[model samples]
Target: MRGEVEQLVGILFRTLAEEGYTEAQTALLDTYQSKADTDREELAEELFVEVVTNLSYHLETETEVEVLVTAIEQLLSWFSSLVEAAPVAILAVETDGQIEFWNDGAERVFGWSKSEVHQRPYQDVFAASSDEMEPHLAQLQDGKQLTGLETQHQHKDGSIRDVRIWAAPFRTRHERFEGATFVISDVTEQKQREQRLSVLNRVLRHNIRTDVNIIHGHLNQLAETVDDTTEHLRVMEDRLSNIIQLSDAARHIEQLRDEGEDGLTTIELESVIQERVTRLRKESANATIRTTLAESTAVVAHELLPYALDNILDNALEHNDAETPLVEIAVSTGETAASGQTTVSVADNGPGLPDHEQAVLTSEEETQLNHSSGLGLWLTRWIVRNSSGTLSVNKSTWGGTRIEIRLPTQTS
Candidate 1:
């Protein structure tokens, strides 16, 4: 009798499956197995009633199944098109790091055919780097989702490309690890823009602060010399000169802020440095200026490239304590496993900053209202942050401070 009942339940489940009552059919099978004295006809009637009631509720909530399905299909189709059209690589990998699916975008960005990528280990696509893989693997292992992770991926052509990846784990109804889906976006250009903005912001702030200090010193002198007509005339002349300098500084700051990352255009970095050095030489006739720029070193930045160079040189000269201060400028461009970048170094034969002062320059803390001398460096740091580049201070070859700024070469 039990055997007959089992056979009857199987038949009912098959019938329901054929009628598209997938979930209801599974529920009926579960119920029949749990009940010791199962009545086939009664169980079928109960399942039918429950299925109808549940479907009716869903229909009321959804309005219409056909419409909902159509909308869903359309959305899926649109997403499919978008994934196909995107320029960056995309892949879905199991929690075990096995590739489950690869989109056309993956082929375009990673230079791998679908057959070559599918079911392969995700680590195969990553180049060997000390900082690579560990964080991503840890996140997956911990069952936590990760997003906006910037890393380098090895392409089929033996080149590495910078990519911003977002990953999230997927699960099935049985609560099993389905895998993780990754969306990769090429961010080489964005990174470069950030670097340029950082450098520009730093240069602007440093120049402004330096100009303001000079203005302050002149104002102090004017206040003291105001008693006599001859002294007052001298003070007036000094104030006028300081005002002009301040105005130029303000204009330069505005230009840096306005140009942003999009302002980077192909320009000869050597020429920009040379022009800045020439101007510095004229302005600081007593100071010694030298350059060691690579003749072929080219960079992409706004028309204000000369200004950034000028600010660095100006800082070196203004901060120096030597009788005839020396400023050394060096430029270099090179390719790395990830991308190409240009580095510029401005060093001065002056009193090198103490370790604590160097810390203050790089810290995100706002410059102190009362502290003097380091404000220019603070501003330079800010510009470097905006440009999406890095700024570091170290001992120069001349036993002074060296300010190094590195900017990415590519936009994307």
Candidate 2:
């Protein structure tokens, strides 16, 4: 029994030594070596009391350090909670491209649960091919931080999501770079809005420059000729009105931006069309306006749908060379409520829209030679696009042009 106690005490001291209790290890070693023949029970108790005393002394002396460690742990826990609850995705990845952390926001934004992606390769979260990820990985490995990197990622549903990422490399206490933390925000809507503004800004500047040059030439011509000035004056006045209308169209774009998502509201399609038809009838008495609107056709569209309709209706009449321009406005819906679409069509019995004029809506891009005569059609297309709708220009049954604006039904 005495030999067993000695062995156990020796084992305990060895464990303390392995755990870096150097003072206790040294004391135990000195006593063990110098007092091998001493009474085993007395030796055991003496060493036990010495260890207990040292433990108590250390505990008392390091109370503040322990408290500080506890506080730091609590602060880290709070920071982790904040990152998890953030509205944007937060990801932590190792230098080896392994994902270490995926917060709740990451799961929400990317549609991948932490359990699904934890410890997976960072490449798994992005849609980019390995070749495409190489450059970004190289940059990270070089300890470079990336900011506002506008890119597209794939959601778990296989749909694309536009995002802007901010990432920074993190290091260990010894300043060795180990991994990167990524902060990603969904910027899909914002990018779309910026694209819209860019397109409109470019087109407006081009058209305004052309109109100004034409006006300058007209002013020079008027200065050279005083006879039959009536026609020249009419042309100048028309161009001036067009310039004003273009400026107003820019204001409409601003209004759309200002209103943003709030601009979309449920509207009764038939009533809105009837109201515009009535107003246009008063404005263009010589033109015949007809409507075949379905009763209570409701859709979720931009509040500026009426303005879009006005542009189409007015274009149908204005571009018509017919002595009695006949304009037809019709509203149609899918066969079933679940089909989830409503189409408003404007047809005209006149010369069909020229390809250049239609290019503003149909073509992916507008060149200097392939641009529209005005911004009306462009504005209409912009409104339809921002409303999450589609606009189609096709041939009408009456040997003219038919413009259709398709919107999501309220039931959708």
Model 2 CA lDDT for position 233? 73
338: Cα error in model 2, Å: 0.6
Model 2 sits at a Cα RMSD from the real structure of 23.4
Task: Provide the TM-score for each candidate, comma-separated.
Answer: 0.41, 0.50
lDDT of 1 at 12: 46
Off by over 4 Å in 2: 1-90, 93-229, 258-260
Model 1 worst lDDT run, 10 consecutive residues: 1-10
- Per-residue CA lDDT of candidate 2, range 321-376, in tens? 98898999899999998889899989999899988888887766669966888777
Q: Clashes in each model (backbone N, CA, C under 3 Å)?
A: 22, 0
Candidate 1 lDDT, 1-412, residue by residue in tens: 3343334334445555655766656666665566536576666655545544544553454533443344445556766898788877778888777788889988877788999977887886665574577678667656777777768878888877778888877766676677788888878677779668767666776776677678668666776766645765666666666555555655555556666665556767777777777787888999888788876676555555555566667768877998889888888777562666788988899988666667755676755643434344455555565566787889998889898888766434
